[model samples]
Target: MIRKLYVIITTSAALGNALSLTNQTKFKRSPVGGIVTVRAGYAQTPFPEWLTEFTGLTEWPGIDPPYIPMDFIDFSKVPDYKSYPQGVCGVNPRESCSFDCDKCVEPDDVYTCSKLSQTFDDGPSPATEKLLESLDHPTTFFNLGINIVNFPDTYKKILDAGHLVGTHTWSHPFMPSLTNEQIVAQLEWSIWAMNATGNHYPKWFRPPYGAIDNRVRAISRMFGLQAVLWDHDTMDWQLIAEDSNLRTEEQVYHDVQLWKRGKRGLILEHDGSEKTVNVGINVSKLIGDDQLTVAQCVGGIDYIHQYAQK
Candidate 1:
C-alpha cells in the first residue's frame, strides 16, 4: 500500500477532492436517461486505498459486476469462508448471522438514551427534503452511493439536519454473491462517495439486503466501517409496488405497535421514494418524538470521522 501511494502521488484522493471536479453537476443523464457521474480528474492509477473498479459510471455498478479480481485488496483482513448448514444464509440472514451492531442496544457498550431508534436506508433520495422536514428527532441514514450522487444537494442536507450518516454501499448488491475484490470495490466506492460529497468517512455501514457474513464483516472492519443490523424491519420499500408483497402504511404502523417496550428497536425504514417517505413521516408521528437517531441511541457523539480530522 505504501509503495502504491508512492507510485501514484496523484492518487484517487484527488478524485475525492471536491476542488478537482470541473463539472458543476456531479453527474449527467445519458441519452437513455441513466445517471452517469462525471469522472473528470479521476486518477489514471487507482490508489490502493480506493476502488480499482466500479468507479460509479452507472447507477448500479456492483449489481451485475463481471466479478473481476484485483491485487490491491488486503487479503489478510478477510476471513475464510464457512458453510452454515443450518440454512442458506444468503437467502435468510436474520436466522444465520442475527448480528446486532448498535452499541446502546447492547449492554457492554456505554449506555445512553434507551429510546427506540430508527434507521432509514437506501436514501438520500428525491424525498429527502420531506423526510428531513418530517422528523423532529434525528435518525441515521444508510444511504446508497447512487442516490447520494443523484441527489447531492439533498444528500448534503442530511448532516445539516443533525442526522448521522452511513454508507449503504455504492450500488445496493448482495454482498455474499460478490467476490472479495468486488466486495472491496463496493465498500471503497461508497466510502469515496461519502468523503467526496460530505467530507465524511463513515464509521457505520448497513449491508444491503442483510447479505453479510464473517468475511464481509472482516473486510468492512478493515476499512473502519462497522456493519449494523436492524431488529425490526418496516418493509416500507414494498409501498412502491401494488403487488401482494406490498406492506401498507397502516399495516406497518400496526406492526410497530406490537413491538415490546424498553428494548430499543433499530427499526428499518427508508426515504428512497415518495410512498416510503410518507410512511416514514406517519410512523415518526405515531412513534412520537421519543425516538433517537442510531448514533444517539448507541451513545455515540458522532458516527463519522471527518476528512478534516484525518
Candidate 2:
C-alpha cells in the first residue's frame, strides 16, 4: 500500500525558495500542475532509500535501499541495439573492454585539453548553489537522475547559473556489472529526468566511481554523450562518506598543489559533501581564472542537446 501526502505552495516565488532551500523537503508537481511538497522527515529515510522507492524497486533482497542494481530496470524499454552503429575498437568507435579504460591513451577515449576543467559528480544537491555562488567561474555538474527528480529546483538552478550539466547515471551504479541494455536504461532515464526538469539533455557523461569500459563508452556514444574522466581526484567522497583518514583541509592543499604543478585537465570532486564545497571555494584562489567547464576546456564542442521545447 502507498500513502500520499501533499503540501501546497500557492506562489511561484515561494515554490522557488522552497525548492532552493535544503533537500529536507521533497517537491513534486501534481497531475494538474500544482506544487506538492512532501516533508522528508516523515520516515527518516535516507536519500538513497527514497531513491529506491522512487524508482520502484523496494522488494528486491540484498539489493535494497543503497544498492543501485535492481530488477526494476526493464530492458525491453531500451532502444533496439541494431538501431545504432557498431563501435570501433580503439578508434572512432571505441570497443567495450573488460577493464577500466579510463587510462586509455586514445584521443577519443580521453577528455583532456590545455585548460583545467572543473567537474563535480553526484549532485544537484542542497549544497550545489552555495558551491556555484562561491566560484566566480562556471563548473561542470554530472548529476544523477534520482537526484534530479528529487530536487528539480536545485537542478534548474544549476542550469540557470550557466554551469555545464552531464549525466552520472540514474542510480550511480558501477557500470562494469550492468548489461548493455541496463546501461542504456541508466543513461536514458537520467537524460529523461533532466529533460523533464530543465528541458535540456547533456552531451557529456562521467561514469560513477570512474568505472567505465568499452561497453559503457559504446552505450554512451549511442546516446550521443562523450565520456569525460578526471585527471586529479580529490577523494572527497571517501573522506566524507567513508570517514577516511585524509583530512578535508589536507585534500584542499593537495588539490592546490596539483594545480600549482601545471597539471591542467579535468579535476574531479563531489558536490554532495560539505568538505568538497569548502575545497571548491578555496581552490578558486589557485585556479579561479584557469577554471573552465568541460565544454569550454574541450573548445566549446556543442554539449547541449535541445530535447525539450523550452
Candidate 3:
C-alpha cells in the first residue's frame, strides 16, 4: 500500500513544545483559521529490500503525537458505496457475469446512484504507465508505492503527471515484524526518496497486506499519518488459481463475493504485478459503465475524506 504525499514543514523542537502538542503536524490557530505545521526529519537512506517485503511490520515515526488529518479535505460528503451499498450497479443474475457470488455484482446493477469511486495501490510500474496511457477514463485516486526502485523513472512520470504519490516503504515490507529502527528507516528513506524526486511528504499510509497492530498504529500517529485500509479487495494479487497455466477463477469468484459483502470506501489493489494490473484496468472499465470513478477519478484520498464526511 502506497501512502499519499504532502508538503512537510519543519519547526524547531522548542516551538513545537509551546503549543498543546497534538501531532507531528501541529494544528494551531493562525487568526484566519486552524493551521497544521508538518515536521521534516533527517533523510534516512536506502534500506535493505528484505526489510520492506512483508509490509506487516513497518514502523512509524519516533515523534510522539496524535495523528491528525494532514489534508483539510473531507470525503464523507461524497456519494459512495457507504451511501449506496448496492453500488451504482445493482444485482444481476449469477449468469450475467462469470461469478455466481452475490458480492461480485456491481452496485449500479442493483441501485440508484450516479457517482463513482476508485482507489488503486502498488503502482508507478511499467504496467501502471501503460495502464495510465490506455485509460479511456482518468483514474480517480492512485495510491502509489515509493519503495520499489526498479521503476524510478516511471515513478517520476507519475509524479510529473499530477497523480497522488504515497509511501509503500522502500521495499513493501510487512510492518509488524520489523524493529522500531528498521521501520523508521524504511519509512524515512521512502519519504526522503519521494522528497528528493518529487518534493513532498506522504499524507496517508496503507499497511502492506493491510496489516496493522497497535504499535503500527502508534507509529502512524507519530508521523501524522492516518493508517488507511480498504473496504473492497479484488484479490487481484493471485495471478494463478488452482491450475498452473490458468488464472484462478474460483479465487476471482471469491473476490467478487467479498467485494459485494463489503461494498464501499477504498478498494484495495496493486500495480506492481502484471496480473493485478490487468484486473485493475478491467475493473476501471467496469467502474465507468456503472458511473463510478476510481479514487483518482474523483480526487484521491482528500476527496475520500470529503465523501466520507457527508
**What's the lDDT for all of these models?**
0.60, 0.58, 0.42
Q: Top TM-score: which candidate number?
A: 1
List residue ranges in candidate 1 displaced over 4 A.
1-73, 82-87, 90-113, 242-245, 260-263
* Model 2 agreement with the true structure over 1-310: per-residue lDDT tens digits: 2221111212222323222322211111101111112325222112235435556554222211232433544444443322221121232232333223224433454455477556888776667768877776777888877677667777777887878888888777666566666676778677766766767778888877566655566667767788877656554544453324424566456555655566567666778656667776776666766677887776756356665453
Off by over 4 Å in 3: 1-116, 136-149, 240-263, 289-310
| Cα misplacement distance, residue 261 of candidate 2 (Å) | 2.4
The alpha-carbon lDDT assigned to residue 144 of candidate 1 equals 78
Q: Rank the candidates by lDDT, best first.
A: 1, 2, 3
Per-residue lDDT value at 53 in model 3:
55
lDDT score of residue 268 within candidate 1: 77
- State the lDDT at 95 in candidate 3: 27
Judged by whole-model lDDT over C-alpha atoms, candidate 3 comes out at 0.42
Error of 1 at 224 (Å): 0.8
Q: What TM-score do all the candidates reach, one by one?
A: 0.69, 0.67, 0.51
lDDT of candidate 1 at residue 43, scale 0 to 100: 25
